[model samples]
Target: MYYNTNILKSTDGESICYYRWQANPDVPFKGIVQIAHGLGEHAGRYNHIAHLLQEEGYSVYANDHRAHGKTAEIKRLFGYYDGKEYFDDCIADMYALTNLMRAENPNSKFILFGHSMGSLLSRKYVIKYGKELDALILSGTASFIKVLGTIGLVTASTVKTFKGRERGNAFLKDFFFGEFNKKFKPNRTKLDWISTDEAQVDLFEKDPYRTEDFSLGVFLDIIKNSKKVNSPEAFKATPKELPILMFSGDKDPVGEMGKGVTRVAKQYEKYGISDFTFKLYKGGRHEMLNEINAEAVEQEIISWLNQRI
Candidate 1:
């Protein structure tokens, strides 16, 4: 596949930045993979995966979620939201992008792949639109932690009440995400847990679009929506045959060191979702795509998708 960029207007009346890897013109596309990226990262970061998929004759697409990446850098949004239903806008962006891709390539089966925050959004996506897609893949995922989320919600509320919606707070960043790197003792950087690859970690740190201090409004939005998607009622509503694949590293705190990942799978099991697959990579970390053994992980993903498709 080859790479290119384009822009489309989202429902919020802002131009969305997106990237695509087109399948080889000489080869038939096996399917389409539309990625919903994690928080604090841009769609462009998946170029390596997209290139691999293109070689495999699969068209791949990814968009910068609102208030992040190039989308955030845009002058109109400037990495801020109105503190009202911002999470809903994030879901709607994926929905809009899906529709556009479907229209462009009607015959292709569209698969949803989400990581971290994107995985959370994908949980919400499957609840509402599971029947519309072929499969779902979640990486660096976990079931919600109500206690911590509650604390975050209170923090966001207090900050928003005092400083207003547009204000970014370092407290939320430290309180919620500060400990991720702590688990990796003598860590070179606060993000060593993301992947073992030092170069990738450095790249992520230097990336301009990688968010540092999140505003109170967006922080609360993550907690609020996470609670919504992690509900049993939400899991019960998803179609039984909607194939789901979730993988995380055993050391990933985001996945609660793999406990939360299993919980999510078991929740679906309770709901009678038959076609579910999960894995906890031994000695792995949060960002499996950028992990030291990412090639093996990618092959595993390919094998799973092949079986499902």
Candidate 2:
């Protein structure tokens, strides 16, 4: 599989860049897999996953959000996006790109896969654009408690008054994710929460596009959107028939040892979602796709997609 990079002009005047990977033309494609990557990472990181999906006759697409990855590196939109509705712009970007690609490949279904922060955004995406997709897959995701979200609002609002949005701040990252590496006390790298695979962690560390920090505004937007997704109202508008797979690591701190991930899945059920399932990978961490047993994780997801799509 080959990754073809392209830039599309967004409705909001910003240019969005994406990677499109098509399956072998000799075989009929099953559908389109459009991925929304997590924060501090780029779309290019999913190339390996794209190739795997392509082998199964699925054309995969992953886009860099406004201020991350190749889009940010080339356009210089790192650490911050252009507007206050940072989260809104991200969903809009996905909506635009998904429609464009779906138009070109109208014969097959569309499966939206989101990881980590991308997973949080996908929760919003499925609710708003549920009718547009055939299936949804969420990885490395969690349900955010309202109180924690409120704290984020207060902290970010106070921090912005003093530090502003244009500049990067390490305060939130240290405070929120600082404990991730504590479990792996003898770990060689700070991003040990990502994966036990040292090679993958090293690649992530060396990547220039993967910035280690984010702006206060960006963090607040994440917390707010996360709260929105976990709330009961988020899924009221979603189509019950939309097949969703919510999978996370049992040991992932982000998901609170699978408790919040389960709540997220249960919240969807409470709101009338009827065609979804949740799973936890034993010994898995935050980045299940990049974990030591990543191949098994990828195979399992592919199986699930085949069953639904």
Give the number of the best model, judged by lDDT: 1
List candidate 2 segments past 4 Å from native: 145-150
Q: Clashes per prediction?
A: 1, 0
- Quantify all predictions' global Cα lDDT against the true fold: 0.84, 0.83
Q: How big is the positional error of residue 199 in model 1, measured in Å on the Cα after superposition?
A: 2.2
Query: Distance (Å) between predicted and true CA of 88, model 2?
Result: 0.5
> lDDT tens string, model 2, 122-176?
8888877888789999999978855556666788878878878656667677766
Query: Which parts of model 1 have CA positions greater than 4 angstroms off?
Result: 76-78
